[model samples]
Target: MRKNTIRPTDIKLHQKSRVLEVAFEDGSRFSLPCEYLRVYSPSAEVRGHGPGQEVLQVGKENVNITNIEPVGTYAVCLHFDDGHSTGIYSWDWLYHLGTDFDELWAQYLERLEKAGHKRKPAPAAG
Candidate 1:
């Protein structure tokens, strides 16, 4: 089965808001939070050596993307302010993440809760 590879038509990083806006060739657009990308990084450090070895990333609520560099023609290397830059995000992976945002995010929160890890608390309202 030969699957068609769809590439992003545009990628915009909102540094202040810490969101990465990606639009694909199929006209699908997604605004993914930097925290989501950092925590779900495909790097070995985050993904671990194999199945069931995944490390739960905590305290990434305030993580910022310092850079986004194209990795050949198939992926992009995201450099996070937290010093994680090994993840090579493939087009297909990114697309799947975007489309599966809600489900994945809920799973992440559940994992964090089970591990007794908490993200940084939001600032109190003035």
Candidate 2:
């Protein structure tokens, strides 16, 4: 284990709500939306091979996670309902996603706007 690495103590997938709730050993918890995870996937298909090669994800407003597979003790692979299952989300990366969600989401929205894409409104909870 690396120094200062935070590990998830519990992970819950709320299928109806379409969110992944993760609680860490450090007492931090995050509720990550499936669409957000899909768009920010660490897979080469989404993140690409290099910094400038990132392919912006679009039309993922209603995406959801269908399954979660453990990948050793270091990470977990998220299988999205849209058939995207290549991102290996590490503990550190998950923590980063949790802590930096606001900024990252803002950036994602900005990128979408710049690309002339408009996000659809979230579905109402019933």
Candidate 3:
């Protein structure tokens, strides 16, 4: 028998705060901002088909998740208020995003700065 991988035990969307809280079986929990998820979407529309083809997402500071649809037992499709719903976030990918949030977020900010895009401040949590 193979050892099982860490899987999300709970996922909650706080529309008011614009955050997705995910708790994994490994006792790790992440409160991921909607803006972060939108910019870091794994969809081909955002990630592109190959390396060095990533599209920089801007003006998404206030983007919020509109819906969460489960896909099979391993993934979910997040529908965003900005009409972006193509990204199918797998359990493994979501776990990776949670674990690597800090570095990935910094990289995204750096990319935005390099592109001369000034990101708006996130809305205050209510």
Query: Can you tell me which runs of candidate 3 are displaced by over 4 Å?
Result: 1-4, 124-126
Query: 1 or 3, which is superior by TM-score?
Result: 3
How do the residues 51-108 of candidate 1 rate in per-residue lDDT, one tens digit apiece?
9989999889888899999999999999999999999999998998899999999999
Inter-residue clash pairs, candidate 1: none
lDDT of 3 by residue, 1-126 (tens): 114667899999999999999999989999999999999898999999999999999999999999999999988999999999999998888888899999999999999999999998875665
Q: What does candidate 2's lDDT look like per residue over 8-100, in tens digits?
A: 999999988899999999999999999999999999999999989999999999899999999999899999989999999999889999999
lDDT of all predictions: 0.91, 0.94, 0.92
Residues forming the 10-long window of minimal summed lDDT in candidate 2: 1-10
RMSD, candidate 1, Å:
2.3
Q: Which candidate gets the maximum lDDT versus the true structure?
A: 2
Q: Model 3 has how many clashing residue pairs?
A: 0
Best by TM-score: 2
lDDT pick, better of 1 and 3: 3
Between prediction 1 and prediction 2, the one with superior TM-score is: 2
> Which stretches of model 1 miss by more than 4 angstroms?
122-126
